[model samples]
Target: MDAVAKEIEGLTFNMLTFNVVNDKITQGFANRIIQIIEKHNIDQVIVIADEVEEPAQFLLNLASAARSICISQTCASYWGGEPLFLGAHELSWAPGMFERKMDKLFIDNRLFLEFLDTEDIKMLRERLPKIDKKIWFASTCLIHGLYGLNYENNGCVVQSCISDGNEVERGLISITHSSRQDERFKSLVKLREYHFIPYPALACYIEY
Candidate 1:
């Protein structure tokens, strides 16, 4: 796998894209991500997974241990009123109640849309500016929908193809110069067993 880093207008953006052979995210994989965070000096970490599967739970716990901000989409069975399509069910700061050891912020994406106007997206954009540089660890399935939001906010996005199997469908794009090959980037490539490709801009539809 390849890790690409580029500096744009004083902001450092790094992109790591790889396929997850199977629908599994092992501890080894999560640890490698942590190493990348440290290697890049990531100031903020965002984990976005729609479902709290066993592997996703583990990743969340690990990210929390590293003091990362975690957000996941929750099942809609617990909603009491007319379902809202663009907001979170709850944002909790305590740990242990959820399957993870960190704060549990759950969004309701039952009527999931490929738009950048959702409350969670807004929340993400708001929180991103707090850190000068940040990285996002999201589900590959959600990357298509989130790319626009991440680009507009100027944050690095990373994802493993857990739900999408071994095919990585899209790549994050930046209007910056070509990526620079550095020691950290080489280490990231060595950390992954999957074949890595540097950043490639793929078109995604984003509703207004």
Candidate 2:
């Protein structure tokens, strides 16, 4: 984990993702994120909810977790809460001319999420003229490509996975490796890497 984070921090455009949905290495997926923030000395973070099973819960935690969290102000309104930074100029790109060959939504309904609609994205584009784009920052979210999960220079992509084990049994980590270019995995590979693998493999994130 230390190595992974370091490699990411070294990026020309530094970035990383968290499967708040699942921790690919130890258990306590929730606390593990908090630990990562402290361990890596991360100052700000973005939390993206892949599914809506618990948006409020995640947001509440996110609110408490970051130094100050910034979300799509529109999504905050849709969820009925005011975010610290409600205006994200980047939200402007409402997705266009998708080249994906699968799914009818790819052609017609590109907006994609419950709270994220094309209209909000369009509105964001309108306000973008005022926001400068020269800043470099780290983002942690479950959001798809529009959120910038892929590291183009290295041709590296961020992936996530979850386990289906019973409540009593610790679930295995689900590792979905895909091209950083693909929005969410069109397909996935489930490995017991999270709970089953040796933690040393995660030399990328942890210190010896």
Candidate 3:
């Protein structure tokens, strides 16, 4: 924590990505982030890593301070671009399928639904029920049961992977350097287990 004060010598930071919903961002802390960003003359910032409903206000505050900000729709990364919304929703059709259940977990959040554009809403409503059933069944099935999908139940909700959510068909996808990737000639696709489907109970914010 002391590092924030030491390294922050009015540097021109390219980004300041915070997990908005995380408890670390109390009112006083939020104000301090604003102060730090402003003091550093940050160019732009990436939105909170995953959905933490409470920190929405803090994110908005940072956006106001930075020149621009972009939140991942699911986990969309940008190399360079104007601020935009990210809507990353994934699902599978078959019951007992792991991927399908993961998608439903993301959709149930009220904050997620609110940010989703019209197209996103349309896509989710059509796929929700089928996706939910599979995961629900899997939760009970001892052989196939992967366990609960929440922090309390020893399972966590996976947020982003390939954006399409077609892991079996598409292979693993890791989101790197978001928008403006075309110009930077960067690889947006990555392969990593750090962000995988069927979340675990432990939630550690190690740089993905």
Q: Highest lDDT: which candidate?
A: 3
Candidates in descending lDDT order: 3, 1, 2
Off by over 4 Å in 3: 19-24, 47-53, 72-194, 197-208
C-alpha-based local distance difference test score of model 2 = 0.28
Could you give candidate 3's per-residue lDDT for residues 1-208 as a string of tens digits? Answer: 3467577575665556544432234567667767877777765444344332235455446545764443333332331332223222222222222232121111112123223343432343333333322221111011112112121111222122222233222111111122211221111222122233432211111123
TM-score for candidate 1, residues paired by index: 0.27
Distance from true position, residue 175, model 3, in Å?
Answer: 19
Top candidate on TM-score is 3
Candidate RMSDs in order: 13.9, 15.9, 16.0
User: Deviation in angstroms for 95 in model 3?
Assistant: 36
| TM-score-better candidate, 1 vs 3 | 3
My TM-score estimates for the predictions, one after another, are 0.27, 0.26, 0.37
lDDT of 2 by residue, 18-113 (tens): 533321223244455555555554544443322233333433444344442322211223423422222222332221101111111110011123
Error of 1 at 53 (Å): 7.9
**Tens-digit lDDT track of model 1 for 157-196:** 3222212334343322221111211101111222112223
lDDT of 2 at 194: 22
Give the lDDT of residue 120 in candidate 2: 46
State, as a TM-score between 0 and 1, how close model 2 is to the true structure.
0.26
